[model samples]
Target: QTDHYNLLKRSGRAKATTESEDKFLRVNSLRDRWLIEQQLQAQLNTGRSQQVSVSTVKRRLRAAGLTGRVTKKRLVWATKHRQWTTEDWKTVLWTDEIFGSSYRVFHSLQTWFVASTVSSLGL
Candidate 1:
């Protein structure tokens, strides 16, 4: 069974990268099964090979660990950018490459009032 799978993979029938025309071909965004099928067709439309079937495409994606999940973009917002200012400090959504999602809000400014000039006789 493993041998057969390997054969298919090598023959561009089990691996998504088999249709590598421009170095490598892959479906990045798999929003739906049908969409993925369409994408595979488009990717294999070089007219130099057999069209990959929906099941084959799906199997290849599974083999490659490409599941149907929206991969959120990770960003280190303040690392190279300015610190969050008071006017822009409302809410924050953060993520990292380590598969983490964090939501936070910060209030870094504080205000205080004091009677620095107290009247001697209740002015």
Candidate 2:
């Protein structure tokens, strides 16, 4: 429930020779928190204003205690260890045989095929 701009403004409002440094850290922390909640994969730097290099960004994020926060996401089907064995895919099947070229296309179809077939048998 922290107000980012307000927090930064308050922190930067501190009397210091280098108030910008404080402001940058505050802003960067806010950005990092936002990126975390949004589940973004990129690491954010408090020092970069489109002027900082990638290496500098990495350093800044590390300095901010955010290095461990950098994470990579897995695919929907990916396993925990990322190593897949044949047994893991035993439930899967691939059929090269084609059923037919085409089947009847039904529109708004709602026939009780099972009941009708049963009744047709006169049982």
Candidate 3:
């Protein structure tokens, strides 16, 4: 962004919109920010880039819609059952439901139920 742009040290003349700037650096990980800044500084030395800095690299990453966040993790409940007396069970419906996951990068989501109501599902 303009903020990062102002922080860069200008030194070259190569200013192509589709230059290697977009390809050579991508903030895909935590170390990527520093590494990208180092690489871009090297490019400036060889005149491949006009201005570059850590801030500029981060700005480019942000502009490219790249963001960082802690991954979500949770424990999945497995085979756990509740015990109830016959009189109590008479007022409750007992069943087991089976489900599968949905699309897009490994999610712990339960999609449509593949089986419902143990008896009808023949489980």
Candidate 4:
């Protein structure tokens, strides 16, 4: 008789999330890019006695190719510059590069973004 079993068919525990749940995660993640894993887990665990852990939510998001990042705040234009007339602005030269000493500021707020969006945002 031929052997019916194959070594490639290794068995293990199934995934905690279903296809629909994964879809829901992806949709909501895309809709709100700033939601943290804890927040996402709370949303998914609403009305359930057994709640999913934050790690699971994170793993699921990572599997979906989404990652968390710290969003950088853009430099705000000075109030004095807002009142500048076209003629006044003409005196200043605008270029992509900063010419003098500059300070870099970063915010600690955490947010999530897809891999493609992260690259596009230059984060």
Candidate 5:
């Protein structure tokens, strides 16, 4: 982040964090993906100007497993996209078990699990 900050500064494109061109334009699809991953209603509200359609934001959120409602514009998944098969759930569990205790040699397993899940999924 520091490196990218420096690059942005040198490139003369830097703006206030709230209204940075990077936030509005430079980030592109990845920004939408990230916003959906975050799923913060307030952040979504603030990120886009008032005139931006709610449907556009909802579209991105739905794609990123952040929304469940079906709208006439898009087909709804039979289930939320984040729902995994039993086998997939088992894999997620095993991965969590193996690494959950190792995040910090000091943090408790449960704490690490919550923190890691939140940080990794950007929830």
Candidate 6:
């Protein structure tokens, strides 16, 4: 009898990226969470004739459990202190060392923030 399962398994086309390329993409993505798929694709395409699509880059990233999220706007502290005078500023405590995490979100015609996960970044 002819085996149908083996025949069925061999039907689809090969993936665009190889194992090494996928690993490179994942490592770069983890290293720089803000990198977009287009940029990643461009980097991957450099020095190679075979170019991968942005969607393919996105798919590879998604497979590695990375997703894009929009960063929420924080309350503007400067606005609250806008009316404060020199005397008011002197009354506040000043610290030479700052202890807090900071992540800058750049905005342009479109905004996209990429992170491994919401829980990972504690967002």
Instruction: State residue 57's C-alpha deviation in candidate 2, in Å.
Output: 1.4
lDDT of 2 at 45: 28
How far off is residue 10 in model 6, in Å? Answer: 1.1
Q: In model 3, what is the error at residue 53, expressed in angstroms? A: 2.1
Point out where model 2 deviates above 4 Å: 1-26, 32-50, 73-123
lDDT tens per residue, model 6, 19-70: 9999999888878766667788999999888889999988887787666543
Off by over 4 Å in 1: 1-23, 27-35, 69-123
* Cα lDDT tens digits for candidate 2, 24-95: 543554454433311221233233354334454434445444533222222223436457678866766867
Each prediction's number of clashing residue pairs: 0, 0, 0, 0, 0, 0
Give each model a TM-score. 0.31, 0.26, 0.28, 0.53, 0.20, 0.54
List, residue by residue over 3-112, the lDDT tens digit for candidate 4.
78657855897777777887788889889765667678888888767778888888888888777642432223444466889899889887776554323222333456
Candidate 4: which stretches are off by over 4 Å?
Answer: 1-10, 70-108, 117-123
What lDDT would each prediction earn against the true structure? 0.42, 0.38, 0.44, 0.70, 0.36, 0.71
Candidate 6 overall Cα lDDT vs. reference? 0.71
Please give me the total number of clashing residue pairs in predicted model 1: 0
Q: Of the candidates numbered 2 and 6, which has the greater lDDT value?
A: 6
Name every residue pair that clashes in candidate 1. Answer: none
- In candidate 6, stretches whose alpha carbon ends up further than 4 angstroms from where it belongs are 1-9, 70-105, 108-123
**Number of residue pairs clashing in candidate 2, backbone atoms closer than 3 angstroms, sequence gap of 3 or more or interchain:** 0
The TM-score measured for candidate 2 stands at 0.26
What is the lDDT, from 0 to 100, of the residue 34 in candidate 4? 55
Q: Check candidate 3 and list the clashing pairs.
A: none
Best by lDDT: 6
Pitting candidate 1 against candidate 4, the one with the higher lDDT is 4
Segments of candidate 5 deviating more than 4 angstroms? 1-50, 69-123
